[model samples]
Target: MRFDTRLVHAGHELAEGTGDVVPPLHLASTYAHGVQDPPAYFYARGENPTREALERALAALEDVRFATVFASGQAAGATALATLAGAGRVIVSDDVYGGTYALLTSSRLDVRPVDLADPAAVADAFADPWAAEALVWVETPTNPMLKVADLAEVCRRAHARGCLVLVDNTLAGPALQQPLRWGADVTLCSTTKSVAGHLDVLGGALVHDRADLHDLFTTHRTTTGSVPSPFDSFLVHRGLKTLSLRTARQVETAGKLASALRESPHVAEVRYPGLPGHPGHEVAARQMSGFGSVVAFRYRADVAGLLRRSRYFADAVSLGGVRSLAQCPATTTHRPIPPDVRLRLGITDDLVRLSVGIEDPEDLLEDLLQALSPS
Candidate 1:
């Protein structure tokens, strides 16, 4: 089956005897075991039927062999570093998510920030002696800034030096982009965002094609007890069915919003890969199926007032939900980074990040325009 068809049927097996179409939500923490032969699932921490279904669906969507689901995106990230990074340095994109920034900086890993959007900078970073046996972390169409990286180039450079590459695929879920196809060794995602579609579920996943990496991540998840609940797994799995549809509408709306923002006199700058003016537009066009649903722009007027006046867009943090969300990255998502450092990265106080939802495009656009217009 194709990608969209697989989304509906990948992990679904009709309930035995009942012939129910939807997969059953298995909630049992422990399964019955015999003396001679142990059960496939003895405990929930190591295994759960519902969670396994979600993992299978995730792996199928990424066109990979394995996937390990986590309680949160941070847990998945921490496990990826712990199991794969070894004792070598970890090179990350400079415009990474605040949680990711804090995770590497606070840990013992030798974390170095590199401008991953620039191929020359990536080449230079990999040339460094410290980069040998390192892990290169990438977040394309990166958090808040919407900067897309050249995945194939970075993967080529990193693999040339025997280094592994992990891509945070939260901003552009599998429906829009599959990093493994572009040579990413592992794809990390916040299932709490796009994968779940609705805002209710909180989970994460790391999808890859290697059995060795899968075994390592699964072991870490089991040992650390960082597994998602059966219900969260069910929610995310259900969300998978509509991913292609939701992403398409959201991407269409996002392009409209980006174009509108650029024309707004109250807006200073607009950042969206769909825009030809964006630095990473070409690479994004080549790698991703769609430009994604997030549109970020620098508001020339009061950011707080804009947030307060918007009727449809919620003043919130997370993205890829059914409802539109607006946030000031300098204060919300990227607050962990120092002001000076954030300024250097173009994350100004006036920057407003919008996660375009499945709402009517005209309504969303009018709300944004009125909010940005003189109060």
Candidate 2:
């Protein structure tokens, strides 16, 4: 089946007894079980029918054998890192999500930050003797910076050195990019954004082919109880049914806005992967099917003021919604990152990130124009 067909039909296997077309939210925390009989589901923490259906759907969508949904994107990320901590030091991209950064820095693992776009630097990082046991973390079209990593190249280099590669696919959802196909061992995302895209739900997920790693994360989730609610899982599943339609519309609007921003004298740089001048445009072209809906640009004027002045876009954090939003990474999404580190990663005070929505392109474009005008 095509992707759309899969989205709407993959995990929806309903028996005649429960003739409801939509799956019910299995909110029962515990299921009836007897010691003499084997139980497929004895506890919600271990498994819930609603979460299972969503996981199955996501796994099919991401082209992976397994998936584990979490309470939040950070919880999924932290679980992946924590599971691998005993293996060796973890290396992450410089523009990694601030929450992911906080998770690693607070841990005992020697979390190293480097430029994943620099193949030579990545090779060198994994070449160290310690690299034999290392784990490589990548976030292409990274957070607010919008930098793209050569996921295929990074995976090749890491796997050659016996390191595992995990790609954060939140910015470019499965509708646009699938990292596991590029040799990444695992792909994770905040389903809260693109998957449950209406901005109505909060959930995270990890999808991969490896059985061992699947058991590891599943055990951790079951033990720690960081699983998402059944209702949230149902919402994520529903949102995915229309993901491709929403993403395509958002990406089209983003390209138009990015071109306009690039032409502005007040703009220092526009970091849309669809834009030719963006450092990651070519790499994104190579690894992704679409350039995603988010665009980041550095402007010469007061970015905070620009965000506040925007009429169409809500000045807020978080992306992947039907309504457009603008935020200054320094004070919003990436604020948890140390100022110096943020600067080193090119997240400047003048930088603004936009999450394009399915709104009319002209309105979004005009809103940006007015905000950046010399009025």
Which candidate has the highest lDDT of all?
A: 1
Instruction: Give per-residue CA lDDT, model 2, range 1-375, as digits (tens).
Output: 889888888887875597767767888898887752676887888989899888889999877789989999999988998897568588889888778888888888887888888777887887887777688889988998888888888888888888888899999999999999899988989999988889999999999988998899999999999999999899999998899999999998999999998899999888889998887889999888889899988889887678778898999888999999998888877888999888888888888899998999998898889999756
lDDT of 1 by residue, 182-266 (tens): 9999999999998899999899999999999999999999999999999989999998889999999999999999999999999
Candidate-wise lDDT, in order: 0.92, 0.87
Best by TM-score: 1
> For each candidate, how many residue pairs have backbone atoms clashing (under 3 Å)?
0, 0
Worst 10 residues of 1 by lDDT: 32-41
